[model samples]
Target: MQDHISSLNIAPMHSPWIEFRPNRPDAQARVLCFPYAGGSAQVYHALARGMPENVELGAVQLPGRWDRRREPLLTRLSDA
Candidate 1:
């Protein structure tokens, strides 16, 4: 999966923080999206698809969700 993402130029800002759906190296703007309560990075899939070509979409992947289900959940903003 990592190889596939790399091929499409989807690079994570910080592997544990932001997951770019389809990173655009030459994008004119970047939008970082956060999921709702109990949601995961996938929640932004549709938004990513609807964004303009020049706008890059990055989905924030909070710990304790999705692949990070085993990790401890952050209880405070300061913990992030």
Candidate 2:
């Protein structure tokens, strides 16, 4: 299990829109979360704290938030 977890990659990408918090790569399931309206991926940071060691958590960041300041806020629901 440790080996599998160690093999997981959590590097920040160039987009700066996706935030990943890998707790257990060996886990059978991964939990992916989407940020709320006008919110950034970091909004889920606290929620990841109580996740079991066997569960991996990933947060998705949208434009116009956090590091994506240059991006325009999504106005249409279809864009989400």
Candidate 3:
């Protein structure tokens, strides 16, 4: 079962994927991690150490509150 799915190209498809490349250059699989809304990227800093030797850990950094302080947040409600 695993072999069949592995045949397809399943690279990181998540938006703003945090790439945590392993020290080894010949790694096989990479882990794509995501955070919930209003979450910061720093939360996943220690994820690299918990992952397997062959698997690379990656966290996505979305631009909203923490990353972009200069940018103002928009709040609007649309009524039907």
Candidate 4:
């Protein structure tokens, strides 16, 4: 699992918000996945693998979790 994750070419758009796992610049579509409360981007790893090559899978890295643990969580929808 570590090897697979490390091999991905991550392209983070606004680092705090979205992360494309193995970015596909010419993908025909994109899917943004959000984790359950208190969950992290890792939740979408398996899903990303199943995605078609023409579709990009992006995971939302909410604040206060995982690598963003140091950041404060969003209290309002507008802040997100």
Task: Write down the RMSD of all candidates, one decimal each.
Answer: 8.5, 5.4, 5.5, 9.1
Model 2, 1-80: lDDT tens digits are: 87876667654333355566654546544677887666778878887877887666778888787887788987887986
Q: Tell me the deviation in Å of residue 33 in model 1.
A: 1.1
The worst-scoring run of ten residues by lDDT in candidate 3 lies at 71-80
Give candidate 1's whole-model lDDT: 0.79
The per-residue C-alpha lDDT of model 4 at residue 56 equals 82
Clashes of each: 0, 0, 1, 0
Q: Is candidate 1 or candidate 3 better by TM-score?
A: 1
Q: Write the per-residue lDDT of candidate 1 for residues 1-80, one digit (tens) a residue.
A: 74553356443354678887777766566788889888999988888888888678888888999988898999999976
lDDT against the true structure, per candidate, is: 0.79, 0.70, 0.55, 0.78
Clashing pairs in 4: none
TM-score of each: 0.74, 0.60, 0.51, 0.73
Give the runs in model 2 whose Cα sits over 4 Å from its true position.
1-17
lDDT of 2: 0.70
Model 2 TM: 0.60
Q: Model 1 Cα RMSD, Å?
A: 8.5
Number of clashes found in candidate 2? 0
Candidate 3 regions with alpha-carbon error over 4 angstroms: 1-17, 21-25, 65-80
